[model samples]
Target: PGHQGTSLKVTDSPRKRGYYVNSPTYGGFDIMTATVGGVWDSFLGEGRRFWITATSDSHRNVEDGGEDLWPGQYAKTYVWAAPDQADIMDGLRHGRIFVTTGDLISELDMDIAGANVGDTAQVKAGQVVTLKVRLRDPAGPNANSDQPELKRVDVIMGDITGKADVKADSNPTTRVIKRFTAADWTRDGEVITFTYSFKAERDGYIRLRGTSTDELEPQADALGENPWPDLWFYSNPIFIRAR
Candidate 1:
């Protein structure tokens, strides 16, 4: 009920509005939808690399006359940390996490210089930074009984202008900086690795998102269409401080 669009309003002043679209929740379960990344990039531009996680808040099962998927059955948040509870908490607090829908990907790793997600890298402005990304799709079928294929990956960047410059809506300055095709990457047994190099012009953040669907652009969902066929995965951002 709270997730309904009519009951929601996008706002930067969360203290006043008491609510904001945490991430775009449109077209049902289209996890690769650009709307979510757009919203996240906006916050990044405001110097807040807001953390995001995926969960199935399944209060009741559809078989029991409810409309929700079981927890970890549809979406899951993976945190890279030790087995200890405290470490897991620390990982989440630091934004070292990734989310997958329909189990599209089993592993996703990214690094810049020597910093990984949730870590900040300091470098001189105009210096080129190399980003390395490794991803692995599940070799077997997911819950939906379909083996997903990695189609493409996108790198999104947002310039951090500080909280004082934050806007109340979408940040026009943030955008997808690069897109990579799976065919160009090194692959072996469902795993693929790729690298990107870019010159730092200013302080910013970068994140990754990939999809199994071949649609280059997000498609509008028809009424009552199923969203389980499309799978997507998103990674937390890595901050960059260039002086």
Candidate 2:
């Protein structure tokens, strides 16, 4: 029961055993697609939550080798069903997922219960926590990918200590700010969100980052690369407890 070869030798045998012995090496050939999203966020620990599916381990449409990977090219986890031939594999095993390489997002939702972002659900004092995004437009835009550019939607709330300089035209679509709080919004979509209301004494945790078109530079670029083309979406951080 040990035959997981190729992908260039399971991504080149752990950097060839850390250069035979030198040590200090990184990159695990995309680390099995990032451990399939960190084994589903490490089994949704802590407060317990789970919902993510976008598999294509199709094995070349159930055939032979199929030139190794090619059936939807990667990505499809749009759960929350109502039209299917089998509930799309039971809504991807019950997790109503979403992930696209070509883009076809029909619906995306996020509620912060008692929101906070420039004062919406009270809790003032530099308050700010309102990230709502909805997208729908992708019936046809393919040619190997690259036609989904709906950038700038980052509303981060924790873990960077401090950062401010959002002036991509002095507020284009929407991005309100006012920090010094701590966690309470786990995560959202349309591209990135993580808030939990930080400030029981300021520990950390809260996120939101959805801006693409390769980010047009000057916004935490840092050698930006890949689909990170400005980071279209990422929200998964809502942990705070300082009592």
lDDT of 1 by residue, 202-234 (tens): 998888888877766555443333446656677
Top-scoring candidate (TM-score): 1
Off by over 4 Å in 2: 1-46, 55-143, 147-150, 156-205, 209-232
Count of backbone clashes, every candidate in sequence: 0, 28
Specify the poorest-scoring 10-residue window by lDDT in model 1: 1-10
Q: Return the number of clashes found in candidate 2.
A: 28
TM-score of each: 0.83, 0.24
Model 2 poorest 10 in a row by lDDT? 1-10
> The CA-based lDDT of model 1 is what?
0.70
**Candidate 2 on 1-243: residue-level lDDT in tens?**
001111212232322311213322111112211221233223332222334333333333212532123444423345556787698666555444444433433344443433311111223334443434344434455433555554444344332122233321121211223321114223333333333332333323333333334332223211111221222333333333222
